[model samples]
Target: MLKIDSIKFDDEKMDNDRLNNYIKKSEDAVEIFVDLLKMDGQEEVVGMIALDNDHRLIGVLELMRGGDTFQKIGTDDLFYLALRLDADSIILAQSKADGLKVSKEDYQFNEFLIEEADKFRINIHDNLIISGRDYISIS
Candidate 1:
């Protein structure tokens, strides 16, 4: 059996006030993700923003964490949470502890995510790579 863990959000640990201000823009998405992840000298982490039909914040999911080089996220694993939350759209994000440049792997991953998202009737609004004090949107 391929067991998927139950997704949970630690409300107390998240900056809900800052997150609520995000309005689906790439910049706002980056701000919210940076605040949530606080990727200061830390390893790479993958996260997702779940949104309702109106683009309101549903919640955030921290999907995977890996060393400096890479982090892996599976479409099936991500969509499981989206389905559970009944989300209409999702914004994907990953911390690039190295810098703000988008790697070939990043491009391929976002491409795969977009194709996979369509099958579930979910819109992938954007994919952001956050670095020190900057970000790049590969939507």
Candidate 2:
């Protein structure tokens, strides 16, 4: 049998200034991708930005990483994290090393996310496709 004890750390409240400043628009999301993701690589990646009810960012999660062309996002896993983080809404983003167009699959996935989020009462703010220095909002 394995027993696990809870670990604790000092709590500190931080201002939401940085997140509020950076995530104002779809283009800002592209800037976040450029800074956070290793876009020079050949692999495709899917990530989410969790936000509170006020649209202030809570955190960013990288959900899936796959080959240059394909990455599948698990809706259950995505929302599970959101609930764990106590997020009220989320922005979905994917990287395409080849181009900046939102694929049909991406659109379908966003629709699926919207449907599932409704069931959970979570908001799906936007879906973005990022490639190099550019991005497209498919919301």
Candidate 3:
């Protein structure tokens, strides 16, 4: 099982850069395993999320092309996956609010159900999802 501590953050707490930093720092490589999804009653590549090496979800990643690949490079790959699921906007907003400052790039994550809330740009609702994911707290 990969403990949260084991998975250290490179930038601020929830900065999207953590993903990139994790790949470079962790001695144990990151492995991606996406489930085959189905519209109703057909076998597909988009299904439940899982983990590798004893099966413990340290964090989340993108699901692309029926099978999960060892994500080594590119934000586009994750963006593509979000695009596939239609949750890009939320991801982009959250990633931005959480990602690093000095480093910036093309806005990503335009998939998933989108909505608005008080300054806290969140995708999931019913409660503040980014309670701890905030890297910079604007006061």
Return the top candidate by lDDT.
1
Rank list by lDDT: 1, 2, 3
lDDT of 1 by residue, 3-118 (tens): 12243434343345444533556766777667766654356877788878877667777777776433445588789888888779988877865767777887887887889988
Error of 2 at 134 (Å): 0.4
Candidate maximizing TM-score: 1
lDDT of 3 by residue, 53-100 (tens): 222323343232222211233344443443443331211111122223
Clashing residue pairs, backbone N/CA/C < 3 A, model 1: none
The runs of at least 3 residues in candidate 3 whose Cα sits more than 4 Å from the true structure, single-residue gaps closed, are 1-72, 92-134, 137-139
Number of clashing residue pairs, candidate 3: 16
What TM-score would every model get versus the actual structure? 0.78, 0.76, 0.21
Give each prediction's root-mean-square deviation over alpha carbons: 6.1, 6.4, 15.4
Ordering by TM-score: 1, 2, 3
Give lDDT tens digits, candidate 2, residues 1-139.
0011232312432343223332557766666555665443356877777778876666777777776433445678788888887889888777876777666887887787799999888898888877776778888
Instruction: Tell me the spans in candidate 2 whose CA falls farther than 4 Å from its real position.
Output: 1-22, 68-71
Model 3 earns a TM-score of 0.21
In order of listing, the candidates' clash counts read 0, 0, 16
